[model samples]
Target: MTARPTKGGALYALPNALWLTFFFLAPLLIIVAYSFMKKGLYGGVENEFSLRAYALLANAGIVKVAFRTLLVALAATALTILIALPVGYNMARSKNQTLKLFLVIVPFWTNFLIRIYAWIAILGNEGTINGFLRSVGLISDPIHLMYNQGAVILVLVYMYLPYAVLPLFSTMDKFDFILLDAARDLGAGKLESIVKVMLPNVRSGLVTAVLFTFIPIFGAYAVPLLVGGKDGYMLGNVIADQVMKVRDWPFASSISMVVTFVSTIGVLLFLARQKRPGVSKEQAAALAAEAAVAAGGGR
Candidate 1:
């Protein structure tokens, strides 16, 4: 039977509802409200309602930063997914899934800023990579590895890889490996068998991973700030600069709205694809549902 919320359930849900209201929904509504208000001469938003903040999005410089943010986010997300897919598949099939998952999650035990700085130690110009190369007499000058778009993307991938892996592993764990053998018997190539048979079944995990990695990277700030140097400007930095440096709170709120909107849409997309617990999708139905998405085009 379908369960319905009882009148008494409000008592049980009150604390969580109150928590979301204060911590999440309240701030989100404030940002939405501020996005349409006038920017104050000093810092905060003015009482006067205006669309100037949204209008500022057309500024050529901000547009360029947005474009760069999109590119970097896409590159980082793609790399994370590519690396995570194999690792997830291996873990899903591993004899020691717990150990592999534990190792994947160990990074989270450290403070995020410390982890970023740790990368700096490894990738900085005079850091570990260069020191090792110089010790081996590989070169005279230190190789420039830090403070670029590449570094930002690389670090982003490293940071978000586990998010992709966990979701992919969760979905792939349910996948029927026997489907691959059947595809092989039908004369499918190895890559074809995996891509056509395996990936189609794991669409939920792939979508989850993509959204999880892409959204966070799109709004990345510290990775770009510490490692991106002059070229790694992104929308998150723009929002920070507007609020802290430029003192344009309205503009910052508007950009925050954009990020929030994108995140909401991603969540909706995930909800649309999520399979109900204890229910399974037929392979043909799954392929049909995801054809326009995963397959992209014909062979």
Candidate 2:
């Protein structure tokens, strides 16, 4: 027979349930409703229903901004993964766990805006790097270091590095390094061993990292606003402009709904991938045995 939840359990869950319903579900419902409404003459939404806001998405400018946002988010996610893998691996394998934790935790002590501002100072034309260069006679004029696409991507990668690394480190922490030695003994080179053994084991963590990094970067506003000038503006900037400057709440809501839908689909796909059945221990052992046999034959 199935056991029923206790009164205490119900009581404990009540607050969390209320919080989600009031905060998340309520806001989401409002946004969805607003997306279908008309934009008021001054600001906010109107009582009339219309699809014009969604139709606006077909505009070439809006499409281009959406495309650019996706491109930058993908680029940032890929770069974060590339850098985070080694850092996560080292953290997981390190004997000095204190140092590893310190490295991860220290960055969080600073405010996120402060860190972005720090990047601004470092990347601006009259900023630290350019100032130092000019002082040392490296160039006659300050280099255009800030307000560019590259600077935006660089800052995004830095901001999201911890997100990628933490999930990877969590997964790698449970990994068996002995598998690598076994693969090596079976004549697999370093890269082959990693590809064939390590990656398969930690695929879930990698997916989680990618999702976390990609979703936030996709919706990023301030980073692009400060560092990304006209050339580097993203969908988030467009949404912000619509809401604050143009006061086009309906159009902004429609854009937000599109973002939410796309992000949800991406998340669902990752979850589906994670839920797929993987190879059993016996099959893995068989593969290892075959590799050993092949190695022996080559010898």
Candidate 3:
């Protein structure tokens, strides 16, 4: 007799369901509601409906900031993936995988703010690089390094590299290295084998890494504030300014809504791509089961 599937899986999923409802959905709903509401004269929002917040999105300053944010997010995410792919591959193939992974995660042990300040100390006009250069008489003056878009990008890459690496490593660890050999036997070059065989296999990891790195970077506040200075004002900074500096609650909410919408759409598109043609339903189900087990162990 064919075994009937039980409803036990739904019971096991209850905690996560409730957690998303309360933590994610509820807050998203609040933001959406606020986005549609009118802004108050002081600090709060009014009950009446208004499109003024979204209309403000057309402002030249906000649009410029949004464009700048997009460029930074793309550049940072691209560099992160490029760096992380090789790192993840090396870690996956390393004899001491556990030690390497520990090293990758060690940065998380410190407070994030402390790390940003550390970068400031290292990159300031009179900081370590300048000190070393001056000592060698390379230049009479210190090069301007900190408080620019370059510094912001550098710190962002440093901050999110691990986020990209972890997911890529996790996926690569499960990949079959034999497929690469097979491709090589078929006369594929090393680069071709990796691009044609490995990347397609680790696409899930790429999706996860990009999502983790790009979304957060797009909405980043502190790094841009601390390292970017005037030119570093991104959409995140705009949202903060609208809420705190301008007391424009609705405007902030609207910008937040845009971010949330873009993020959601990106997620949906990527998730849809996870399914490929020619993969049987049974295989899909098996992959899902494996992912669930892996996620459980990760938790």
Candidate 4:
């Protein structure tokens, strides 16, 4: 039998629907419209429709910057994953829940800009490290650490590591440790058990972590601007310059649209991959049961 629709549920969803329409969808539509328009003689977009802005994206310099941005984002995501895996695992398996929560929450208490500025102080030529070294007569001159690609990547990894860890820890928390025992009983080594049993279970978290880390890093402006000099200038930096300095609104809008489109496509591909056949309902149920047993044992 078909169930009747509930007016109450619709009422509950009204506020959220209105919020999205006003805040997200409306602004997004405006950006899309602007992307198609021509740039004014001085600044801002004109009403005249044109594809010139998008055409500009095909320029060799712009293409190179885009590719460089992608490469740096990929590298940062890889490093974040490598560092986050062990941290998340320890957080998930550790008996001291209070410490784990403290570690996660303390970083959030500090302002993000302050954290970035702190890095600048540590990395700058006349900053803490160089000052200490000079005081100790360790070096005649300061090392060139700030305003480089390596510094940009380092800061990015630091910024996004928590994003990766939280998702991974959430998935790992519900994990069935008994599955590892089962795999070992079936003649699998520790590494083989983790690869064959553990990772597959947390695939969703890993994908979420990758998306969270990659998208933000791709669109990052402040980090690159502050730490990234000529060698580290990304597409985001170019877009920011076009809008703020060059006053080329149309080109900036087009670049923004391209980034949004590419990010959407990447997310869609990841979602599609998740739907493919592998993990079965029975396996899932068994894992749940194992987790329940483990929880009871802990209690």
- The digit string of per-residue lDDT tens for model 1 on 205-282 reads 788688777877888888898898768888988999888999998899989988878778877776667655533445
Residue lDDT tens for model 3, 120-176: 989998789988899999989899998888899999988888777877887788899
Candidate 4: residue 221 lDDT (0-100): 83
In terms of lDDT, the poorest run of 10 residues in model 4 is 290-299
| Backbone clash tally (model 4) | 0
Query: For residues 59-129, what per-residue lDDT tens digits would candidate 4 score against the true structure?
Result: 99999999989999999999999998888788988999668857765664566777789999999998999
What TM-score fits each model? 0.88, 0.88, 0.85, 0.86
- lDDT score for residue 134 of model 3: 92
Question: For candidate 4, what is the lDDT?
Answer: 0.81
Candidate 4's displacement at residue 29, Å, is: 1.4
Give the residue spans of candidate 1 off by over 4 A.
275-299
| Residue 206's lDDT in candidate 4 | 74
On lDDT, the stronger of 1 and 2 is 2
Error of 4 at 185 (Å): 2.5
Instruction: Locate the minimum summed-lDDT window of 10 residues in model 3.
Output: 290-299
| Candidate lDDT values, in order | 0.82, 0.82, 0.83, 0.81
Badly placed stretches (over 4 Å) of model 2 are 1-3, 274-299
Distance from true position, residue 273, model 2, in Å?
Answer: 3.9
